[model samples]
Target: MNTQPDAPRHVVATSADADTVLRRLAREGWTARSGFALPDPAWDVAAHRIVLHGRIADDDTETVALAVLAAARGAGVVAVCDPESAAGRALIDDLSRIGAVHRGTDGADPVASLIPEQRALLDRLAAGDTIAAAAAAEFLSLRTANRRIAEARALFGVRTTREAVLAYLRQRQPE
Candidate 1:
């Protein structure tokens, strides 16, 4: 396992998402490879990228992919799937929340910005509960809750939890 704290991260939650991103990247003249395992022998992540596709709920695929990620270090890993599927959504959300810090990119994608638990708390807040109340409902300590709220605020580029909530809502609003 590479065990490096900073690594590039990428994910496409559906085959369609994969197609769209890949097409765009290709248009930008980037090279990519799609597969179930890491590229053999040697691969330059900065120059070449890999996309992993399949149901995460399927037999041990996620586990293996995680192992591969650990070994590959700087390589970009894209999880491609059908986001409409429950498993796909879960995978995307999970990856988004955890992978954001590792992406090494300038700005975070709002959709993948929060972990499910944080999002749940935000949902409660959006429904009009006080921050303390929402934190209590989620069984988080006041300190931990505040930490998560702060993290969410930083992720969304806002100063207050309410602003974060509004930003989240705006992001989710349909165009």
Candidate 2:
């Protein structure tokens, strides 16, 4: 229910890494995930950074990194390699072309920050109300309402308000 989305995710490709990292991260107060397909459920609010294993100075590694990035759509990724190594530097350069934000624990609880107003707006949006109507229901002006929805759009990394609402529902909803 977080009105503002979390930073890039901290994810692993396997539960083994997930397990170990989870334990270590738990000590440091970081939430983490592992072993999931990069399709369907969006991960923007969950994962903050990606920790890649092995030497990431090759085409294969970049391909893997792109997959993870696609899942969360974050600023940048990190690899468990020698940052000073030639390959590592090259990988960094390649990824920097996209963007890189250090996924931090400040984003531990993606749902913890949902404000009532934002949730109400999303509820209206999910209920199929127009942005104008939804805003009016909340006694807000159209511009203000659009701004809030825009936040949801950016936070969920979707192009449309409907997609953002869907992302909100998927995460906030119970299976």
The TM-scores, one per candidate, come to 0.50, 0.39
lDDT of 2 at 86: 55
Residue 59 displacement (Å), model 1? 5.8
Give the distance in Å from residue 108's predicted Cα in candidate 1 to where it truly belongs: 11
Query: Candidate 1, 132: how far from true, in Å?
Result: 4.5
Least well predicted 10-residue stretch by lDDT in candidate 1: 97-106
Candidate 2 lDDT over 1-175, as tens digits, reads 5453333323223335434544564564444333223333455534444333222333445544553465345322323333345544444444433333222233333332244556789999889898889989999899878766765565566799778888888878463
Candidate 1 residue 45 C-alpha distance from true site, Å: 9.5
Residue 105 lDDT (model 1): 25
Tens digits of per-residue lDDT, candidate 1, 1-175, equal 5343333334444566556655655565555555545555565343344434332443444644563453254444445444446655554444543344221123346646466667777889889998889889999888777777776787787898889999888776453
How far residue 172's Cα lies from its native spot in candidate 1, in Å, is 4.1
Lowest summed lDDT over 10 consecutive residues: which window, candidate 2? 96-105
